[model samples]
Target chain A: MQEKQKPYAYAKSLELFARAAAVIPEGIYGHQNPAFVLPGACPYFADRAQGGHFWDVDGNQYIDFQCGYGPVVLGHNHPEVEDAVREQMAKGSCFNHPTRLMVDLAERLTSLIPAADWAAFAKNGSDVTTWAIRIAREYTGREKIVMARGAYHGAHAWCTAYPGGVLDDEKKHILSMRWNRLDDLENLADGHKDRIAGIILTPYHHPTYAAQEMPAGGFWEGVRKICDREGIVLIVDDIRACFRLDVRCSPHYFNIDPDILCVAKAMANGHPISAAMGRKNFRESAEAVFFAGTFWSSPAPMAAALKTLSILESTDAIPKMERLGRKLKTGLEELGQKHGFRVTASGPAALPYLTFDDDPDLYHIQAFSRHMISRGIFLHPHHNWFICAAHTDEDIDYTLETADEVFPEVRKEMES
Target chain B: MDEILRASLFLKAVLPLMEDLVDFDTIAASAISDKRLILQFEVKNGPSSHLRIEGGKIRHGIGMHQSPDIRLTFKKPELLNRMFDGEDVRPGLRKGFFHLLFLIREFPKLAERLQYYLEGDGKKAVDEKTKNFQVRIGLHAMLGGMATVASDDASLRSIADETPFGTLLVRILPDGPFGTFTKLSHNGGYIFESTFNQPVRHANAVMEFAGPDAAKKLIDGALNAVTAIGLGQEIKIRGLLPLIDKASIFLYRFGKIMGV
Candidate 1:
C-alpha cells in the first residue's frame, strides 16, 4: 500500500506560456515543445536547474531525467564546466580569428578518437552532420548518401524527420535503409553502387515514439564491408549518444570503425559546440568543402568542452550512469510487473526508454508518463530519457518509489 | 499553383464538401429542402463533376451525370476555377436555363456560408451547433483537399506514388466526425475513402483530436498541427507517423492552394 501524492501544479508556467504563445511560435518550439509532454500534467517552463534536479516556474521540483534532451550529460549548470566557460568568456568568446582553444580541442579529439586524424568545429549537430555529408561527397566525388530510415541526423533538410519547407530536390540524392537490416544496406549499396557518397548512421537507432534498437550482430561489420567495397564513406552520427556511451565516442564503444564522425549534444556539457572528425584521407576533401558558420570559431564552448572531456576521462561518471540506469530499469520493470503491466525497457542503460509491451497507441505509456511527472520525475513520454552522471542511487530509489505508486494508477485508468 | 490541381480540388474536394454543409448546416439544408435537381458543371475537354441535390441533401461526384436537369459548360478549367474563386465568370448553359438560374442565384450564398464557417471568421455570433458544423466541415475539407491534391498535384502525386499502402484515420474524439484517407495502391493511385462518423478498427496512423475545440483550433490556424500534436493528450498522433506527416504536408499545400 502506497500513499497517494499531490500532483505538481503549473499555474505560473502556464501563465508565462500563455504570454510566450502570443509572441513566440508554439510558445516553445523544437524538441522542448510543451506539446511533446502532457501539457496540463507537465510544467511548461523551468526556472532553474542544478545537478540532476530542476525547479519549474511554479516552484515544484523535479528529478530531471530528460537532461535537456541529451545535452546536459555532465549535468545542468555543472560548476566545473561553468567555471571553464567563465574563464574563456573573460578573454572574449567570438573573435576575428580562430582561437587557440579550437586547435587544442581539435587536437584532443583527434588524439582521443582512434579513427579521426583531424577535426573541424561547428555550433550544432546539424552543422557538422551536413558538413560531414559534403566532405564525404567531395571525397568520393558522388552525389547520393544513404541513411537509416527514421534516424535523426539533425534538423537539416537532408535528415529532418518533419516535412515542412523541405524540397524533394534536397532529398533526391539521399537514400534510406532500414536500421539493423544488413540486407537493406547491402541492397541499397548494390542498387546505388558508385553513386553513393556515404552511408550515415547513428551508433544505435533511437527513433522517437518507439523503442530504441542496438546494432544487430554483424550489422556494423556488414555495413563496414559494404562501404569499403562500394567506395562510400562510413559516417557515424554520434550526436545523441556520444559521451554517454563512451568517453572516446560511440564508435569506440561499439568497436566499429568509421571514416567520419559527428559529435555534439554532450560535447561541451550543454554548451553550443559540435565537431566533425574525419580520417586523414578525407582531410583535403574536408578543406575543399565550404563549411563555415559565424559562431564556429567561438572559444567559450571549446574551453567548457575541454574541461567536460577532462572530467569524463578523469572520473568514473560513465560507469556510474550505467550502474544507476540499470538499477532504474530493473526497478521500473519489476514495479510494472507487480502492478500487472508488462513494461519493456530498451536501449543502452545510460540512455534508456520504457514502453508498455502491447500499447502501440501509447495510451498506457502516456498515462504512465503523466503519472510520473505528477510525482515529480521528468521522464519524456515520446523520446528516450537520458541518464546524466549527476543522477545517484537516491534519485533512482525515489524514482522507483514514485513509479511504484504510479504504475497502479496508470493501469487502473487505462483499463477503465 | 497548378490549374489542374486547383480545378481538381474545386471539383473533387470543395464541391464534395457541400454534402456535409447541407447535412450539418440547417440554413443550407433548409434553403434547398424543397428542391430536387441535378446540376452538372463541366470544363470543355477537361475535368467534370456534378452535384445532386434532393430531399434536403447534397451529394457530389466526379464526371457528368447521365441526365442532369442543369448543365453549365466552361471553355477551360481556369474558367471553372475562377468561377469557384469568386470571379464573376459566367459559363454557357447547355440545359435547364431555369434550374441553372436557380443555382446561379442560390449557390453563392451557400458557398459564402461554407467559407465563413470553415475560416472561423468570427464575423457572426456562433452557437455550439454552428461551431461543431464548422469543425466537421473543416476536417472534411482539409482531408478531402489533401486526397484531391495528393492524387492530382504532380508534387503530391509523386509523394503519393512513393507512399506505401496504408490508411490514416483522423477523428474528433468522444463521438461525431471522422475521416480516413487510404493509399489504395502504389501506382494504382489514392482514394480518400472517408468512413465518416465511423470508428476504424485499425489504421497505419490514427490522429485523434481530443474534442471539437482542439480540432477547430487546428483547422482554423489558431493552433498549428505540430503544436497541437505536441500537446500530447490534447491531440494524439500514433502509429505509422510518416503517413500522417506526409498527409499533413499535402493538407498544407492544399491550404496554400486554397489561399486560406
Candidate 2:
C-alpha cells in the first residue's frame, strides 16, 4: 500500500504531442487520445511494451491492463507470434493474390469455429462486419438489419462510434433494439418479416463508460430460435471478446450458433487482421459479395494468427488469464466492501469491469484510475480492463494492493 | 376534389385503421399524450395539405401551416404513393425527397405505418398473429419476473425440493381485464407445468399485471420492465427485499429471453 514517490514526468511526451499536433489532426488520434486518459497522470505516448507491462515516452513504466483496447491478449511482443510474423515478413507481406498462409489460416479457423464453414479475411473489425452485412443482404435479398443499440460493431458508417460524417441514409437500413431484449427482437422480426437481412450483436453488451452486461440465461438460445424461424442471418461480432472468452470461439462459450462470426483484436495478438467466418448456407453470398482489401491477404498477420491460435489451444494461457482476472475482481470487490462502497463487477473473467454502483459521473472512478496510473498500474475508469496470459500472480497482487491503497484517496477526492 | 382535399380524405379513411392498429392509451401512457403534432405535406405542381393530430385524434386541411411540428414536402406523387404502398421509401427519399427531411429522418416506421393501413386486411391478419405471439411469449416473461420477485417466498421454499430455486406464480388481477392465475415451475433448466385457473395457493410469489395487453407489451419488448414498473405504473411486485434483487436478475434474464 506504500505510494510511489516519483510523480510521472511527461515533458518529452508533451513536446512530441505538440509536434504531432502540428501535423496530425489531434496529435494522437482515435482511442489513444490523451483526453481519454487522466489529463496529467497518463503519458500521451507509449515508447514500447513487453510482457504485461508498457513504458510511456517519458520512461515511466506501468503494468498495462487495457491491452491496447483489446488486442495483445497473450501480451505485448509474444515470442511465438513475433517470430511467426518475422518469418512471414521475410518472404513478403502482401501480393496481388493471397499467399498460401491465407488458405492455411482459413482452414484453421473453420476447424476451430463451429459456425465457420468458409472464412474471409480483412484488415480490421469494421471490414469484416460490413462485409458480413453485405453478405447477409445478398443472401436474403433483404434490406433491413437489426443491431443492439449502443453496441460497438466498429467505425463503419453503418455503426460508427461518432456521427459527425455519417449520413442518415447510411443508417436507414439498420434498425436498433435494446441489448438482451428478446421480445423486442421478435417484434422487430415479426413486424419486418422477410425484409430483415440479419441481426448482429456482440455476445454481451459492453458499452463504454458503463457497467458491462453479460447475456442472461436463455438469451442466446432464444436469439438463435428467432433467427432460425425468421430466416434471418445471425451474426456474432466477437471482435473484442474473441480468444479472451474461448479458444474455439466466443459463441461456443455461449452455446449458441451464429450464421456469420466476425473476429479480430486478439486473433494475431496485436496484428492488424480480421475475419468473417460464415456457415455453409452463406457460402454463395459470401462469394458474391465484393469484399477485398489490398493488405487483407498479407501472410504476416495470418502467420501470426496460425501460431497464436496454436499456442492458445496448446497452453494454459486462457485459463491462467481467467484465474488472474477472477482474483483481481474478487480483491476489488472485497476492498470496495471494506471501504463501505458498493462495487459492481461484470463481464467474463478475462475481460472485467469495476464500477461504483452509486457513482454515475465516475468522479471517484476517474480519481482512482488516475491514482492507479500514477502508481504504475494502467487501468481505465470508463473502459473494461483486459487480462492477458503474460500477467503473473505477483502482477495481479501488486495491482490489488495498489487499488486498496488508492481507495482512501479516491474516497477523499469524492468527498472534497 | 383538389389534390390536397383528396389526400385529406385519404388521411380520414385511414383514421379508424390507425386506431385499431395502434393502442393509443398505451402510447399515451408511455409518450405522445396531450401533445399536438402538425404534419405539413407539400406537393410539387400540386396543392399542399396539413394534418393535425392531438390527443389520439386526427384532422386534415388544405394549405400549409406556419411553424409546423414536422413538415414533409414530397417532390413527386409517386414518392408519396410508394410511401403509402409500404414499399421501401428510402429509394424515393434518395430519388428526390431531400426536402422531406422529417420523412427521411424517421424513414421506414412512418412510411411503414401508412403502408399498414394501405395493405388493409392482410396486414391486420399478420398483426393479429404477431400480437398473439407477443402475448404468449410475454406470459412467460411475466411468470419469470414474478418468480424472481418471489424466489424466497415460503411457498417457493416448500416447493424448492420439487422445482429447485426457480418457482413462480403469476396472478393476473381482474381489475383491468383478462384475469387468470398461472403457475410456472422450473425443472432441469427448462420451464414446465403452466396451470391455468389455479389459485395463488401453494405458490412462492405473486405478480399482478394491469391487463393482458400490458403484460403482452411488457413481454413483447415493446415496454421495458423498469419503465413499466416506474412510469407505466402497470406492474406490481410484492416480495422479500433480498429476493427483489434476485427477482430483478430473473426478470431481466427472462425479459431478455422473451425479447431477444
**Model 2, position A71: C-alpha lDDT score:** 87
After superposition, which runs of candidate 1 have C-alpha atoms over 4 Å from their true positions? A1-5, B23-50, B62-77, B88-132, B146-195, B199-248
TM-score of each: 0.88, 0.62
lDDT of 1 by residue, A194-243 (tens): 89999999999998878999999888998999899999999999999999
Per-model CA lDDT versus the true structure: 0.84, 0.69
Give candidate 2 regions above 4 Å deviation.
A1-6, B1-260
Best candidate per DockQ, number?
Answer: 1
| Best candidate (score: TM-score) | 1
Looking at candidate 2, what is the lDDT of residue A194?
91
Worst 10 residues of 2 chain B by lDDT: B152-161
Instruction: Summing lDDT over every window of 10 consecutive residues in candidate 1 chain A, give the lowest-scoring window.
Output: A1-10
Put down candidate 1 lDDT per residue, B199-260, tens digits, no spaces.
67778777888999898877777787765554455577755555776788788888888886
